[model samples]
Target: MRKTTYLLPALVVAIVVVLSSIFVVDEREKALVLQFGQIKAVKEEPGLAFKIPLIQEVVRYDDRILSLDTQTIEVTPSDDRRLVVDAFARYRIADVVQFRQAVGVGGIRVAEDRLSGILNAQIREVLGADQVTSDRILSKDRGELMIRIRDSARVQARSLGLDVVDVRLKQTNLPQRNLEATFDRMKAEREREAADEIARGNEAAQRVRALADRTVVETLSVADRDANVIRGEADAERNRIFADAYGADPEFFAFYRSLQAYETSLKGDNSTMVMTPDSQFFEYFKNELSTNGSVTLPDPVARAEAPDAPAPDAPEAPEMPEPFNLTPVDPAPVDPAPESPEAVDPTPEAVDPAPAPEAPEADTPPADN
Candidate 1:
C-alpha cells in the first residue's frame, strides 16, 4: 500500500511537470519562449512546443493581417487648402522575432499605436507635397497619393517589424466655413449664366418680331398692287360697254339721257328750277307744245253722234267740205308767267292751253295722197 501511494504521487508530479514543460502553438499565433524576461526561442509553426518548466514562459502574438485606424487628421495641400482626412492601414508582422524584440511586454496595442503615428506622418508628407492639391486628392489621382503614402509608411514601419500592405484615405471633407463659401460662389455663377441666357432669348425674340413686321409690309404692298391693277381693268371694261351702247343708237340714247335727267331733276314735289323756255334741256317739251298749237282737235260729243266709219276694204269715200278740212296754225307768242303759284303747280292744262289733236278718218282720201 505504501509503495502504491508513493507511485501515485510521483506519477501525478511527473504529469504536472510534463504539462508545464509542453505548450501548444496555434496556427494563427506565433509564440516566443522567454527565460528571466529574455527571449530564448520562437515557435512560428503550429502543434506542440517544449519549454523549460517554471523558468521559461511562452509569449504569443497574432500572425494574421491586422488593421489600424488612425484618428481624423487635418492636412494642408499645396494649394494651402485645409482638409479633414480619415484613413486606415493594413499591416502584418513580417518578423515576429523582431516584433517581439521591439515591443516586449506592451504587445499588439503598443505596436498599433506606433504604427498609427507613422501612417499619419506619411500621410501628411505625401498629401502635402508641392504637386498635390485638394482636387487631386479627391480625384482618381488619390490612388497614386495612397501608393506614395504606403511606400513612405512601409519604410518607417520596418523598424517596428511591421509590413505595410496598403494605406488608404477613407473620407475627406472641407471645413464648414469653406463649404458654405463654395456654395455661394456656385449659386452666383449659375445666376449669371441664367441672366446671359435670358438676354440671348430676348435678342432672338426681337429679331423674330422685326422679320414678321417686314413680311407683313411686303404682303400688304403686293396685295395693294394687285387690287389697283384689277380696279383699272374693271374701269376700262365699263367704259368700253358705254361706248358700244352709244354707237348703236345716238338719237335714242340722247332721248333716254334727257328723260333720265328729267327724272333726276324732278324727283320730289317741291322741285323747282329757273331756266329759259328755249333751253336745249326742254327740247322735247317744246316740240310737243308746237304740235299741239298747230293741229285742231275734234270734239268727243260730235264724233259719238256721227255715223260709223267705213271699213278699210270698202270703196273710197267722197271728199270732205272745206270747213271740215282744218289746217295747222303757228304758235302764239308767250307772255311772262306768274312765278310762285304757277311754277309750283303740276296740272296738265296749266302747262299748255292747246288740246291734243284728233286722228284723221281711215276711209277718206286726202288731197296730197
Candidate 2:
C-alpha cells in the first residue's frame, strides 16, 4: 500500500511536467513562445522544445509554402481580346509577427486577400500592355505569359512578408459576344470561298466541253468533204471506161440505145407509133414477130408484089422558085474618031463634034456660032 501511494504521486507530477514544459514543432509548422501575450521567441526547427510551465506558452504556425486559389475574373487585353483568368498563388509566411499584428488570428486570410488584389493588379498591368494583343497571345504562349506574370507578382508581393512563388490560371475564354461574332464571320467566309471555287470549275468545264464539240463538228465536216471527193473520182473513172467501149462502135451503141429506149417507152399497153407496114424499122419487129410464131411471111418474090418493097424509100427533092422575065439593054454607039482634049469642056457633059465647014446639003449648013 505504501508503494502504490508513492507511485500515484509520481505519476501526477510526471503528467504535470509533461503537459507544462513540452513543445512540438511539425515539419510544416513553427513553434512560437509567448510571454504574457507577447512573442518572446520562435522555434523554426521541427522537433520538441522546452518552455517555462506557467510563464511561457507555445503557439504553432504553418511554415511551409501554401496555396491560395483565388476567384476567376474577366480581363480585357490591349487589342480587345477578352478572357476569364482563374488565378492561384503559392506563398509562405516569412514574418510571423507582422502577420499576426496585421490580421490578428486569421492572418493567412488577410494575406490571401491582399495577395488576390495585388495579383489581379499585376495581371492587369502586364496583360493590358501594348504587346499583349489578341494576335500575340496564343495557346502556345499561355504558359510563358503565366511565368512572366508570376515573376512580376513575386517582386510586388514580397513586401508583405509572404513569398509569391507562382501565379497560375485555371481557365481562359472569350466573351460571348466576341465568340459569336467570330464564328459567324468564319462560316460566311468559308461559304463564299466554296461558291467562288465551284463557279470557276463550272466555267472551265463548260469551256472544255464546247471546245470538244467544235472539234467533233469540224472533223465530221472534213470527213464528209473527203467522202464526196472520192465518190466523184469513182464516177469519173466509170465514165472513162464507158467512153472507151462506146468510142469503138458508135453505130452499135446507138442501135443498142434505141432498143433500150423502145423497151422503156414503147412496150407498155398505152404505147403508139406511126409506121407503114413495109417500113425499114418495121423489119425489126416484123422479124421479131415471126420468131415468136405470131406472123408468117411468103417468099420474097411474092412479097415484092406488095408495092415492090415500098419503092425503096424514095429520095426527097428540093422545091424550085419561078424565074423572073427581064430584057437586056444595048450600050450606046461610040464615035470611032478621036477628039482633041480641047473639044471637051470643064464639065462632063456630052458634046457633039462639028464637022469642018462642009458644002451645003439639002438643009442649009449650020452657022458657026
Over 23-94, each residue of candidate 2 has an lDDT whose tens digit, in order, gives 788889877788887888888888888898889988777888899887777787887878777778888888
- Against the reference, the lDDT scores of all candidates come to 0.75, 0.67
TM agreement with the true structure for every prediction: 0.60, 0.53
Stretches of candidate 2 off by over 4 Å are 1-7, 54-65, 92-103, 193-369
Count of clashing residue pairs in every prediction: 0, 0
**Per-residue lDDT of model 1, residues 1-369, tens digit only:** 989989999999999999999999999989999999898998999999999999999998888989999999999999998999999999999888888888878989999999999999988988899989999999999999999999999998898889999988999998887888877988999999999999999999999999999999999999999999997787667566545644554334344455454555555435556555445565444321133466333222332233143212322334544333212232243332222211221222222222335878689666794
Range of the 10 consecutive residues with the lowest summed lDDT in candidate 1: 340-349
Best by TM-score: 1
Clashing pairs in 1: none
